[model samples]
Target chain A: MTKQNTKKLSLAPIPYFWDRDYTHQFYQQVAQSPIDIVYLGEVVCSKRRALSLQDWMTIGHDLQAAGKQVVLSTLSLVEAASELSVMTKICQQGDFMVEANDMSAVQLRTKFESNAFIAGSSLNIYNQRSLDKLKSLGLSRWVLPHEHNQQALHAFDLGNVELELPAWGRLSLAYSARCFTARTHNRSKDQCGFVCDQYPDGLAMKTQEQKDFLVINGIQTQSGTIQNHLEAINDDAVDILRITPQQNNCFEVIALFDQVRKQQLSVTDGQKQLTECTVHPISNGYWHQKAGKDWVA
Target chain B: MELVCPAGNLPSLKVAVKAGADAVYMGLQNATNARHFAGLNFTEKQMTQGIEFAQSRGCKVFLAVNTYPYCHDLPTWQQAVDTAAELKVDALILADMGVMDYACEKHPDLNIHLSVQGSATSAAAVNFFAEQFNIKRAVIPRVLSIKQVAHLVNNSLVPIEVFGFGSLCVMVEGRCLLSSYATGLGPNNHGACSPAEFVEWKNTDSHLETRLNGILIDQVAKDESVGYPVICKGRYQVNDQIGYAIEEPTSLNTLSILAELKAIGVAAVKVEGRQRSPAYVRQVTEVMRAAIDDCLTRPDKYVVKDSWNQTLGDLSEGQQTTLGAYYRNWQ
Candidate 1:
């Protein structure tokens, strides 16, 4: 491993709707991990209220006490006025940084005079001018979209703000108003009994040939294979690496990334261990400018 | 409500204008627009003639420069904006904030509408675009119920336009990456979804298989009808079942809710295809124009005629239409 400094590990907000106690216990464990910053709040569906704003704040404070930065994330799809109100409330929460997943969240945070906020990947900041506009709107950092390649990132001299890449976990591919999980159970979105909670990682979907295809979370569709960038930490194009929380062995995955990022482990050995840490198949194709499901290595 | 129709070529623009469309929307041949097909959209000279022809018939022309511009391709999108302003279209429909900023600063007097690709489903999102870029109107995504649409109409500072008829996009526009996940190209960047160049169809004695970038999207019996391989609409296996796990192939037809949409103060209704033929433009424009006229003339007694439904159904994908997310039950 090449020695690279100023790289940070972040924990993306949980995309699933786990029960309250299980969520708390998961965060409690996260506090002990080597993650430098932890994103908190629900980003998939507004209906998943197992963890209310107050509950998230409590977790944020606890994590902050554990010497990790905490960021409150807003929903990706905003359809109802009620969802906007919740986003407004999140923006009003004092002192914690906010991640604007949608334009609605950006508007609310700007209205609340947020000084430094993160632009979530779903906001789709593609060019330098959009980044400049977002910077004028008080953006401190932004995540690279899933489809952008290394060549695209080199085009922008993002010197004023840091760049974060989604280094690990399944890529969130799409979002819809209809919940596929609810549809899978023959339930309407309005009458969904929170069945998404039953699948901690999301319901797996495969092609007719039994090849893994996608994961159907509540309103979000994610890649079936986990994206592992353990081999690309020395790329030096990004300042931060984000690891999305998974159902099993997430901390173990984080530890491997920590060791690799710190040059305590060889990239080849870390890549091999990462394959064993998660049950799902792993790919790093998006970083290599291929189909997102392709394992470039 | 204004009847905004689509026109992929100059002939289609003329057909739509003659069919009584209030306005027609088209794109350039490049990736500056969403319908960036190989043989679709207009050249600069064709667009000039199209604008003049539509305006002479008292129909407006809106230019769509709606696709997101990446770091290396910003010049092309900026150039498209300059061309739209030079061509004197009635409005510029844009989705990218970077492009919006350039248009707003370079051509402040030009009218701007938020494209559906902007994916601003709520008033907050619309207001952000309006407040930041001075957008005059917004086309909401096809992911909201009527009640939600009404709420947005009531709260938004700009006029709201909703999709009235055309193919359905199940996922929120601009946010979906299923195509890029499979083909490495999507509507946001490439301005094409499941781009045709990457699609392949294989025939067997008993079945037909559709693939995108070598990934199997769907395989069906030979006798069954086949549609374009949209990733969301393809059949897949989930656990113990094999079916359309995400969504079935369908189109959105909101003729039944024309009165309701007008009652809620929707300023315009948009048709969602630009790669269709001139015949399609003529038929759909005439029906929508007649329907809007009837609804405006007598909102209390306006009804969707059976013949109109029959025509639209025949033109729809898989010969079926749904209320989409407009009806609460569809959600």
Candidate 2:
């Protein structure tokens, strides 16, 4: 862990839905890529069907073989009976670290108590007390909520705490039991013919004014604006810079973050390259105390 | 068999009780409850008088102290709960777990109805409240289909109330922070979503552009109707096609399906607006009351009608209302 903190990037597993082969192919290349840390498992909807536990473990092994730290991530909203089993399986790990997306994950991590686990952005970790509580429960690192801009993150940042700083990604805003992407296709969550695989990026949502509001990934709904913060990486103690994978140019996005983190490139250049990866436009609102769509740059 | 109504003001409480509400729920003029606003909600004196009037009319008064208590603001919540008990209100509708814990511990005998803000969609979640805090009933989420309700009600021990009409949330209740992210005011903690403070309307050439928190939520053509600038009510684009990608500006008018919900063993039908006008309250309550009566009188020949609009007057227009997940899944 100490050796790899030197300007490396992690390719976050595709938070949206993807086919098994696409996921396999994605991780195969990621294992071979410059990404130092690779967080695997489904973080959005439980019913995405892109990867099961066996497939995830296989991919995790492949990534491990490629010389990367594999962290298994849990679902953002753990509601139904089937979801509980998935959450339990993710926490019942020995080798890989786990990211706690919901309170269920937090509870499991609390039982492990001293064993370090990653806290997710969705956990509503606002003040230092909550951060201290997570730390008391063995919270190792955290992916900042997309809405937490540099300012709020800095305010909420436990200055000397052990949690890792999630440097960037498309903010995972909300989650629901209803498969929104499936609902868009007039399909039920149970009977839907796995349509989320068709759009690897996400299904874009527009307002009545025809403006982009959000994107439906699977059970998860994310801000349409890619809440990236590679620009905020200026002479700080950011341990891990997490970037969620898109359909294309994930490797390039990771490379850009690495460059910015190392001070090898200007923040402007790092963010400019990020805009081309095809997730959505870049936003830094959570840092600005403004709307998630409102970017400072 | 109770009708839980919202009273955003003293007058609304009067209207609600006069219009046949078995229970009327109100919050303080602060964020202690989910309907926090500047001019809306009751003052302490207004609440006391409102409670007195409701009790006189065989109507119960439920005080809402539903917002999650911030770590430092527990005293404000504790005082709000204490005040509700001191007023000797019929019941207290609560959402926050800590507040429920406090209320149950302090005033064990005060009736506590779980607020919909808790988002108790499952029986287990409801049972968690019921068994833990002695919660008598729960106001359910608006997302459940009637069939789902039938199944849920058939299996549950606690009585459930469904939101039969009014504001519909695009996502699940009690969890959304989109409003606070967009505006400083959020429904979860702030009790107002797309708060009026962030709303701006402009007549732009051929459309009424309704903006909330500077986000262009809707741009209605001269002929179209524009509803509130809620995130879910906004129109959006998918695959280059744009319209109301989430929900239309239509109100949740499930009065047509009141009998269907009643058949599912729903103990109460909730009307969604407390912030609406007295006339609005009177009209909605009268129509809902009439609908329920109609359900009992002509069970087989009952027909849901659109005359509730006469009560709302011009508050609504050209809404294509689907049963919205209460029958089929939302399209």
Please name the candidate that would achieve the greatest TM-score relative to the true structure.
1
lDDT of each: 0.91, 0.72
DockQ of 2: 0.25
Which has the greatest DockQ? 1
All-Cα superposition RMSD per candidate: 1.2, 4.7
lDDT of 2 by residue, B35-86 (tens): 8777899889998999999999999999988876555666788899999999
Off by over 4 Å in 2: A1-13, A32-39, A43-47, A61-120, A123-166, A175-193, A206-213, A218-220, A231-241, A259-279, B68-79, B90-114, B124-137, B150-159, B256-267, B290-320
| lDDT tens readout by residue for model 1, B1-331 | 9999999999999999999999999999999999999999999999999999999889999999999998888999999999999989999999999999999999999999999999898999999999999999999999999999999999999999999999999999999999988877899989999999889999989999998888788998998877889899998888689888888888899999999999999999999888899999899998999999999999999999999999999998888999999987677
Model 1 / residue B130 / CA error / Å: 0.4
